[model samples]
Target: MKGLFNLGPVFGYFFRKNDPNRTSNFNLRTMHFINKLSMAMFLVGFLVLLYRWFLR
Candidate 1:
């Protein structure tokens, strides 16, 4: 956990200052994609539950 905290600054620095022309890392892109998908799924699930409750 402490190591992650230490790397926070490093990641932040590169995230801000990295070159756009260079090919970025796949790992970060994949994580972001999954995060967005999970969020969308969660919202859809919540809406379904609400609709069921209203129908009840």
Candidate 2:
């Protein structure tokens, strides 16, 4: 659990700091947007699967 929470900052440090595009800030907002978008896609796919399962 501790490692899971720590992973983001560690990754962000690399992606935002080490990457060539350093103009962007390294913080939680970017991470949150990414997470939300990914979760939304997963939810949409899950709902589609459930609808298909019911049709069968």
Candidate 3:
């Protein structure tokens, strides 16, 4: 149950090295890129909300 909400995978997604054994493919790479982008946008939005809330 703890693993379900863990942030480790989120951090790992950005920091982990590529696995040499993993096959590189166009679709998979594109999907991962999109995921990273969405995560970045979410983080930025969250920070902006926090800033506005605190400064108001």
**Candidate 1: tens digits of C-alpha lDDT, residues 1-56:** 76754755534543565568967689987876686678668768989999999987
Candidate 3, position 38, lDDT: 99
- Per-residue accuracy of model 3 over 1-56 as CA lDDT, tens digit each: 98898988899998889999999999999999999999999999999999999988
* Residue pair clashes in candidate 1: none
Q: Best TM-score goes to which candidate?
A: 3
Q: In angstroms, give how far residue 22 of model 2 lies from its true place.
A: 22
Predictions in order: lDDT: 0.70, 0.68, 0.94
Candidates ranked by lDDT:
3, 1, 2
User: Better model by lDDT, 2 or 3?
Assistant: 3
Tell me the tens digit of each residue's lDDT in model 2 across 1-56: 76765656645544563445545465756885688678668768988999999987
| Candidate 1 RMSD computed on C-alpha atoms after optimal superposition onto the true structure | 9.0
Runs of candidate 2 with Cα error greater than 4 angstroms are 1-26
Model 1 weakest lDDT span, ten residues long? 9-18
Regions of candidate 3 where Cα sits further than 4 Å from its true position: 1-6
RMSD of each: 9.0, 9.4, 2.3
